[model samples]
Target chain A: MTTTNGLPPTGKSARIELVCPAGNLPSLRAAVDNGADSVYIGLRDNTNARNFGGLNFELPAARDGLDYAHRSGTKVLLAINTYPQPATWQRWTRAVDTAAGLGFDAVIIADAGLMRYAVRTHPQLRIHLSVQGSATSYEAINFYHRHFNVRRAVLPRVLSLAQVEQVIRNTPVEIEVFGFGSLCVMVEGRCALSSYVTGESPNMTGACSPAKAVRWEQKASGLEARLNGVLIDRYGANENAAYPTLCKGRFKAGDDVYYAIEEPASLNALELLPELDRIGVAAVKIEGRQRSPAYVAAVTRVWRQALDACAQGTAAPQPRWSEELRRMSEGQSHTLGAYHRPWK
Target chain B: MKLALGPLLYYWPRQSVVRFYEEIARSSVDIVYLGEVICSRRHELRLSDWLDLAAALEAAGKEVVLSTQALTESESDLRTLRRIAGNGRFPVEANDMGAVNVLAGAAPFIAGPHLNVYNPHTLSVLAGLGVRRWVMPVEMPRHVLEDMQHARPAGVETEVLAFGRLPLAFSARCFTARRNNLPKDDCRFSCIDHPDGLPLDTLEGAPFLVLNGIQTQSAHVHCLIADLDDLAGLGVDAVRISPQSRHTADVIALFRQRMIGALDAAAAARELEQLAPGATCDGYWRALPGMTPPGNAP
Candidate 1:
């Protein structure tokens, strides 16, 4: 059978699906209209990975979004990606029950225990391992598959394209890689820097650089946005300052201060579409459910054009929309990240 | 309660690692987890040496558990993980789920702290898959553990990270190697220079974090000596004292003394602070910011 992204069943030039993040209904529609083959969203609770204010979907909104995506022949994946506490597993269980009841395609999960529960309680529900789970190797992916019968895995961003290719070749599971958005320096599902400073962990609470912990203060030097009482960046009066995630902060390393973990930039690997498709990546994920609908539309449109070009055995098309995307990026900068080994 | 000395989080000389465990064999610790848990580039102690050390510790009447690297970035990492999981000797502590899968149903194992077992259902699932004991995630509070314990399967014992600098996060990029202007692949075992992790100070020169290769830890060493009563009350089966460069054995002794009521909380806390490589904080166990002192508990 042909995969959703329109690649033939040969598996040689595997069809690459464009998976976009939809924090709200507007973004969901934008993604579907612009060419996202599938969209992933989470409920407006701790059950979802993007547990931020003014983001994510309420139950009604989520059900409506799923219905819309389904009508358009686009798949919708529900992310119940946070690790549940002993007293709070029911909240997650209910989320799984809701997703299955609502006729969503799959639930993206991070916790092994929760994965087992989801596979057992909702045996018909397809499972995709969340990138937050930090499955970095064939062994980890195989473990999830053997135990929870996970159908796919959203590979961690740290892996190179070659590594991704190796993982895809070795396992029966479909491999998903981040094609764009904020490059997390730390492993996604396992990081606790935000929680260490703000009493909320990404793994346990499903948030990082959480909105509540962020505060913008005006100083003599410029504007400063701090996260968890630490000044992440101090921009001059005319210079633009990005929202300070801990990793994307300017810090002193010995005598000089620079963006030690990462420059305040997002990943826009538009140039690597053909390579990713050639390497047999089943799907490409765009990070940032916290982004605006316009941002989702622009990114989805550019990637859609590129994917269509790659499918036709043409030179991969470049969407000359970098200026539009720059406005939406963290600090108007971008990188290919570990995919090209630029950092190395 | 049986004590398990967690893997030496820092990179030291191979001889230092051997000597540390040799000394640990004589201490109050019942189990010892040996191997490189931080960056796999640290080859001061090869797998053969780690296996040899595990045998020595086991012969000394302590249970031994070999630990795999927390961040596995290469095929070599997987090969090492497979070897440790298939060693067929002492149990392996599956730090990452990769190791857990390798050890799953092959033999019983210890789920390390990095596995993030925060709830009971997960605990039950792990117990079913041959995990005999599991270490609680560092930031989980006492009450959460109590709730989990109430639902935990009968045979699985619970362990807490009782003492040492709290491991806050691990990354693919090595901060310690980066600081020394080295690539992670060619880190040259730079983390060995910082016996305790390399202290990272804020712009104002306030100590904030400690860099241990790929692992970032709290600069404030976590001391739960004052919480022995609380730990006992929670029915915690073991208190894991992570090894530091200085006075680790003495710190273990202080916990032993406090556990048996030979010392009060005040005395134990004071001794722990004095023996600490830096300032002491138990904020993780208290569910507060990791750097906050007990006096500032919210």
Candidate 2:
């Protein structure tokens, strides 16, 4: 094992949960075999936010993963985060029942009705408000806490460090902030650009940049990427063509044709872990349910070492940590992303 | 079956905004959503001015709803929201859960589009919390709406963004200010320059998006005048006509005529398209890509 269970805080600051993503059985083992305090996975169906085919877990796999994590004395959080359509509302409620029945640690949810049902039906089961719920303020976080008795709330990636601290200072619920992964740029649960082009979105369909609509072409001029029928980006000679997610697309805003909203970069908050610890962020989440086991192994290893050293009062963001993180990032790059005021 | 004026998405001069609502007070729209829903810094109209206009619209035989900011961050923003919800005048529209916190159980409010109320169970919970009406999220298709209507909580009216450029996304980074090479704190009100929002085109020279402060809307207007009968069948209580700088009065009248059966879908779409900013698309209503307009099939 490259890391410990990560349940007890090793740093001088409070115990901060290192919540990691587990898209499949191997990724879940990579996280548990390394050092995730808790690992969150989704169902294979569209009931979960990461509804990509050939990814995520089936009922048997989910039950198995829960058994593996619980036996290792690690927590397993099930993500039933996508907003269910009226016709499919029963599926979400049933997922909640399944998660509770499986004796999972907590169910991370986004829909209001789902939370209400979870709290009413499974009163003993803990609820962590999913980031897809997009609660950025203390009042909003408190609303969930007051009504549904949510034990934790994942703050959206839009707030700055100072704003995050302010939100923590005012709310009673445990706060979980994004530690690493692809940035949504736009507010999650609100973006429609993917659906506008691909007719699928995280809020409705539980998928962003659905695979069916993506097309790549090597034309005479450059490498071009298109979503549905709309051309998202074109690359020049010797340039790396990053995956065409809607927010990261290069488009024309005014006179300058550039990354209009956000550049093609991943968010790495490794440097801010110290500050986040001082601010009392109860957990740090890593995004990527669609990533492979190798990707998870590399990221989870670095984060585990750093977080452990920080808990032991020996934390130094070693040079190798950033270098490793950079190699695995989108476009081989990363940013603080709205944590610094200039980015906002 | 009914017409409601949505909150204006773009920032305009104070006089122009006042005049736009002054005309709206006498228009065919039955309900009017007021206030700056995009940017908290767009102080062209103060809270008092919005309240006064709400009073004026109520006097003109219209129901008034106060709309809150889509993204509430700063302390001042929350302070403004608490005041708006507790203002004791009209039903407040909770755009975000921050607004819902202030209005929960104390006053009845409309669950604005930003609330992300997609399924019936969420609607049922909000109805329990005193949400009298809720605007369906913009990107939802007709079948989703039909499903929601089937399991909808009792007595809560549903509104849809039946007209105008669909608001695709909102961000903390103000794209309008970013386009002008300015920081958000020192934006200097550049969003006022484009009353209908600054347009963005694709590299292929195709019209793409509209940048209004922190919001990105579709370049082409989204018209559902062609689907009024379908909305009625789906039990949509109100059809929202989002405010545009030009010919919004005409948009309202056209929608109103269709709502009352004074005009058929074919004639209504033709008249409505004449007043649209660019072209019109209703693909999302038909469960297709939002930018793809359902062709003239009716």
Candidate 3:
């Protein structure tokens, strides 16, 4: 059926794909039921993007998820995004080998050295450049494509639509842009602030704002969480507080205290589907593999419907769904950040 | 070991940029990287101006390397990279892969810290592509660099960002421009106002990070004055000193004295602390958390 926007039904006729995250079995089911043309997941351990507690899939679980998605005519992309440390390249190398041997549709990667290794060893495996690579320009994107034969690039969150269009115009690789998720204020893959405070490199370790160092303490004025002995943020009793990731923390500029880089908000760019499609983005990515199954279902359902409507050229009137998203978000707020000029 | 004065990561006046190099020509620094690294918009020194400065430094018996911008946002940026790569007079420090592609096999070049050359294999690849020197990524521990050095291709000189506020990350969204409520394209060169960098403090007024346009740097200047022996043990060829706003030339002199045993480690460490803009940290060298200053050097 066509959406009010006159877009074709999501799976039936759209050129663009709706890519969703599946951290586990239930999230996998939620993503498929909600309307993901494809779901990306990682094997539990340091091999995946969401290398946190209570998330990710085991090998058997990943195998089941892959088979389930394939049976349902959906795709499964494996994320091997983190760089391999000197002593630990074998772990990442094996993850790539496993993902290739297990029939993943594509394996997303961020490390240049690992990309070279994958291209040389697993020549037939499809490689998608991870956003963590921070390939923001046409030249950067083309460099990866020419060198590694990358089939797609998950564009960094920092690009404007105009820049995205320029990149697509100049490069042959398919483009994937973030559609829903907690937006990173800092450029992904390149940031070392978290590693500075804590010792884990997000690029090498697949963790940022690592939980091992996060300490939530209740004080008389409010609640404070220290990330590596530095007080990242504080929230009053009535205020909703998110996990104090380094870039999202409150800071003082001069006399003013504000979220210097970002406030706690999830990026909901569902309304920009038509703009994204017009820019020739080959796929739309939803960014919460560590979130709950319910979260995955709700977000995936909304965007799947939105993408379907956009394809039919009759996207629904902008839904007043901020309240619904706020309930799903970390700080009870959401934004369309950098995608539109929201900074003024 | 020799010292290379890294590119000025801060915005200094045109005169200050020239004067800093002029001082460096007579100073103990053996190599000087001259160019704008933090933001391409901070154009106090254009290509011609930088080349002129490079020529002056070269004339005064110093090796010069032109550094490419760590973050390239436009076609104009690629043009700049191409120009620097083809300059023919001096080596180029390939900060990003775009520059790497342009410089690969053309000539021997220095791979700057941001290229993320974490291991021997990556170094081997770049070495094959003609990287004559590779700067250690800012936070790599001493042991990791030692391991990589052992397996490094011969003639691949290793340089470490031994001093400076470590450049943590670079972005297309300019934080310094955003602080002024300006779009990156119309930044109006606001980063120039803060000659060192715009210091970002925690809500409680703790110094955290310094914002330099698109680049984010550490609040604490990374000082390896006390760890020179360890670095030399790793066979590091050169220690890169990033230029700060004040007392940079003095800091270079102190580093030279310490490296040559003219000053003891304790005296050098004390001098470094006195000269720093803020607290000093060398945890990256020790493999502890980068913000933690190790109590004693190994």
Candidate 4:
């Protein structure tokens, strides 16, 4: 069968693994019960990238979620993805130990030191390189695999479909691509726009446009979204306001005021399943670990159905799937993200 | 401390690019990094042209290091990267791990700031892969850098971005082209028009970011000319001054004079503020918001 990018099938699994996000126990259950092959979670600290308030798993809830996911035959991966401060380095190392002690399937990590610690200490714990690790090329993926024995890598949302296929074709490590969620216009982990405005960043603080730094002020002109008191965007009365991510917010370039970097659109790659499956992608990851359980269930359900349908020879994404996903998308719309070269 | 010129980030006209290096050869800078670190679509100076310039700069008594693209996206980009990695004459500064992978064990190289070497262990890991020196990620705070300097392995040297607008982020989408309302593939090289990057401002007319093709930079210049003494105390070996469209030579002179104690730190800083395109900030050095000037944040 002909593929989208013209690469012949590698005779891999017809049904790819569907990895889902779980911020808390209910979200974990939502992902697990809704047919996620694997579920990823973060600890309730700055060690992981999704350290939002009222989100992620605390110790007790983590144990319960681990038990539930294991009982449901779904693997649980703990994300220890943020870079550790030199003063607080041990906290991140301890997090890896916590994940291993909890009987977690694997540890998704970004810092090389933590990876070294995991490799030396746990020895048997599978290491999946976080997208925050920024291993965009096959050689880079192979570097982590060679040094730390990293088994799987979630690619940063920068590569085109052909580039993703090139990486998968070249590396022995399992490849995971973002299937659906809010789009990060910049390369993951490499961006510092948030920290540039606010002192906190996803790399250092595990939060981008951290909730505490965000302030909303209603003015006669419009509602202004500010991060650390810097005006990110001002919305009109009838306009749909997106979260004030430094990239997605509107700004002025020359004479025109627009979303100069990127518009507020979520990534929905349901149509690219056949190409992803054809290219031998081991897993398709959904991007919101800080999202609600309902969002998790809704996105996971659509992707799960779509993946299954693709296995059964569905060529295009169903209209209903796109409609359902668009409702849950940020800005009430979705784009194919960097998968399509033109989107770049 | 030695003064190093960072890779020219903007897509200058070929004559302007060549002339910039010719001026650099006579400048007070000790090291010169050549080649594209931003978009691959910029073809005014190809790999051969960079090597020729590197050789010319080397002959002119400056230490030369070749820099790879910060984000490697296409097969053509990879081919250019492979050639840069394999360029036996010069040590390559690895901007991505892909470059690190290709250059590792082949020869010792410089780990560019974009590689995200946050802690000593990550530093040691790259050091193990033959990194001779590492440029600190620009947003890294002072305390973290002090800790890294203390714990750095014996052979590795540390460098900091001492001047120029901070490269805040990189995207697959060409923001410059997007601003011009052109597709990336047919961008018509719009970045050439803005030698200092297309300025992006907030709705209230506050300078926010500068868009240069696929890379975004802080609109405020990050000036640490006054902090050279502090950097020396922290064991920093060198400081990089990114090339701006105008007054780079004067900026280099000010830094050189400060290094030799001929120019007072405060005087040099005041002089640098005049030379920079926009207002100056050293907040990243002080570990505050990157745009905050020291003692100026509300």
Per-model tally of clashing residue pairs: 2, 4, 9, 0
The lowest-lDDT stretch of 10 consecutive residues in candidate 2 chain A is A1-10
Which segments of candidate 1 are over 4 A away from where they belong?
A1-13, A317-324, A342-344
* Tens digits of per-residue lDDT for model 4, B1-298: 8899999999999999999999999998999999999988899988999999999999999999999999987778889899998888999999998898899899999999898888998998899889999999999989999999899999999999999999999888999888888999999999999999999999999999999999999999998888899999999999999999899998999899999999898888888889999999988877888999745753
Candidate 2 residue runs with Cα over 4 Å from true position: A1-13, B296-298
Q: How much is A203 displaced in model 3, in angstroms? A: 1.3
Q: TM-score of chain A for candidate 3?
A: 0.92
Please tell me which predicted candidate would have the highest TM-score against the true structure. Answer: 4
Estimate candidate 3's RMSD in Å: 3.6
lDDT of 2 at B120: 82
Clashing pairs in 2: A10-A311, A10-A312, A11-A310, A11-A311
Looking at model 2, how many pairs of residues clash? 4
Error of 4 at A132 (Å): 0.6
Best by DockQ: 4
Off by over 4 Å in 4: A1-6
| Candidate 1 structure quality by residue, lDDT tens digits, B1-298 | 7676888999888788778877788888887888889877778888899888888888889888888888777888889898888888778889888888888899999888888787887888789889999998888877788898788999998888888888888776778777777776677777888888777665555566777877878778777877878787777889899999878888878887887789999988987888888888766666776666777854
Off by over 4 Å in 3: A1-14, A320-323, A341-344, B181-186, B296-298
Of the two candidates 2 and 4, the one with more favorable lDDT, higher being better, is 4
Residue A266 deviation, candidate 4, in Å?
0.4
- Write down the TM-score for model 4: 0.98
Give the higher-TM-score candidate: 1 or 2: 2
